[model samples]
Target: MNQRVLAERARRAIPGGVNSGQRNVPGLSDLVIAHAEGARFRDADGKEYLDFHAAFGPPLLGHNDPDVNAAVAEAGNGADLCGVGVTEGEVELAETLAELVPSVERVLLTSTGSEATFHALRVARAATGRRLVVKFQGCYHGWHDSVSLNVISSAEKVGGRDPISTGILPEVLEATLVLPFNSSQAVRQAFADHGADIAAVIVEPVPHNVGCLLPEQEFLRTLREECTKAGSVLVFDEVITGFRHHLGGWQAISGVTPDLTTMGKAIANGYPVGALGGRADLMDLFSSRPGGPAFFAGTYNGHPAVVAAALATLRKLRAEPVHAHVFALGERIRSGLTEVFDSLGIPALVTGYGSVFVGYFMTGPARTYDDLLRNDANMFIGYRRRLLDHGIFELPLNLKRSHVSYAHTDADVDRLLEAAAVAARQAGGEVQDLAAASTMGGAVR
Candidate 1:
């Protein structure tokens, strides 16, 4: 019927109907986006929707930001140099990031978040000579085999030993001990049991996997202390949280300097760029000399143009106080949504920090994977559709995360609030227990 219809029809002839699952918006069957600028994108169907998803949390400067685009274009004009040599853009980007994140004395750039996470693990393992990796449930480091286990899996599906995913081999989940988030007790117990053999404790500084789950109860403190005592490296996967939480990302916002941190997304203003940086001694594990190992390298690992885009993006972020605008917008969005939920009596709450948030509908604060499994999904499903109908495009499905960008305007905020009003009206005007629906799907349950 339309370009999106034709595109989907044509793409089904291929594999995933879409290139990567990143384009998949859960609740709403989004059409192919034709063009995006600022906080709006026009789909192939010619519908202009306000984009709250913000390219899945990158696009902090909004889509096709002129500054980043200009930098990328200028760099491309130079020599199409795609090698592992020191480029001006790369050096500037590294220095800028180091200035923002004081703990990063050295940095290694990668193509995507997965590559950074994968390399971080290798560095940790090589540095400590430990084989096991400890991870918390519901935290997604990447699609990598080692970090894929326990991510979005319920207490039932992956509790003992059933395959949680179709393609992941069983061996991948064996050594990974999935512990609950925000539980100091679990961390201590895990450390006591396998302290000597564990390589690192990798985590999403804020678990946006199953909604916006934040840290509490000295959970981060325990991890820091235990890893310091146990000779295990502490890695923070700031791929999503990087540059969004603050210019310094989660470590700066949380006041916790992870031994190693993986960052991506907003660093390059929606261009593909991921980086891993940490303590100087640990990053040296990638040296070509005899003592160190060489695990992190790719053809486009430090592509000049992308590095230039990142450099420009970082420069703009520093020069302009846009984060203040985003912080104000985030507070308004969160407050507005909470008030609407209250007035409509919908069983929902907005959980978040700074510019990132999630419309988590449930009782009290969601603290565990089991708790996320118990939140309302049906309501969010219906609500997502209504919001789309109103032309406010946030994640429709219960994606466990909502996002805002530096480009989101006051008008956009008003539109989002109006859309939430419509969605809430359809949600029976009040919050209700979604535990029953949560039990149906093995993934979230």
Candidate 2:
């Protein structure tokens, strides 16, 4: 059946015809996938496209990797969920994380990134005896009330504490201080006003959710230093940047460590898993013994099959040149697309690092959410639609960044660039001369 029929059927059972609101793009056609494997997936319509979404940054080795599948099968054969027990795979996976991630001395496994972040914040509150938490304007931790403010907004209210959803209590919104990302002055001001009551400061070391905004080195250092001085927990939400940016996460790349780190996306390849780990003293709050205060428990915290897949993924990542390979592909796509858009006289900017990349239909480099306002979202979405028509599966609908997997070959990159050229031409218009738009305060690079 067609996607329309499937979507109509889904709407009868599920709200908005989707499990998540953002599953399908706002004004785009429904994308129903039939099956996916290795660098590509076939949609319900039987059309196969080269997959750059990579299931939203989890499939670093690509979809359905043989080793990961084999490991999953082996672990699945062992048990599903022995409710009152622990699995050897969980132990091995935790050990691998402790060894790989610099900040992870102890780990508490959860089912999703949202759960990990929620518990991490709870641990922070318990450790510091504080109620308020600080998160940057566009750095998304998860859907939890503590972090559901100012993550996604239009250009006008980009820096305010605006909750995207309605059900979040005003008290919860008040507890979160949303500051402009990459602005140390704002960070200082927030701490200056509420440092005493601040329980934790959580951030995505690299803010990929807003189309890949890199944190200024000094900005991150300032966070580290200020949190140190205030005795507040510094939590790095590395769900998107964990293994994709590096095996040790962006902390390894930046040399700035957090007291607690929450990661999931690339942890178990593409399996359902999330981990909250950090300094032993702080993580000790999760101990449910006679003395411990914080209670953290989940039935499928570390499912055997998922942990087994994670273990296998970690082994392969350690043994292979995965980062080098994927980074090259990412850079190629970035530069190639930038060249394609530029040559076609389309005002565009490419931003990202390592294995993740995104293109904005704006003249200037996007540093903050406000800066991203200059982007032509309509044009960007139209361009991506043209690419989809050309049989290239990108992050559908929105201008979310693209994930380059180790399974993507040089030929894949070439084909993507080729498709991008066509898309750029189809979406092209009068060349935007930043030199001319400068009078209007539009800067270009």
lDDT of 1 by residue, 1-445 (tens): 5875766685677564666675655533436678899988988878998888776788998888998899888888886765646777778878777788845878988999999999999889999988889888878888788877676665476444333356876676687888888889999999999999999999987888766788873898898999999989999998988887787877787788889889999888889999998898998889633466855568887788888889888889889987898888989999999999988777776878888877776667677777877666767766776788888777766655767787888888898998888887866432233444456653342
The TM-scores, one per candidate, come to 0.92, 0.94
Give the Å shift of residue 16 in candidate 1.
Answer: 2.8
TM-score of 1: 0.92
Worst 10 residues of 1 by lDDT: 428-437
lDDT of 2 by residue, 287-406 (tens): 643467998888888878888888999999999999999999899999998898888777889989988999988888677777877878767777777888777878655558889988
Alpha carbon deviation, residue 294, candidate 1 (Å): 3.6
Residue 300 alpha-carbon offset, candidate 1, angstroms: 0.2
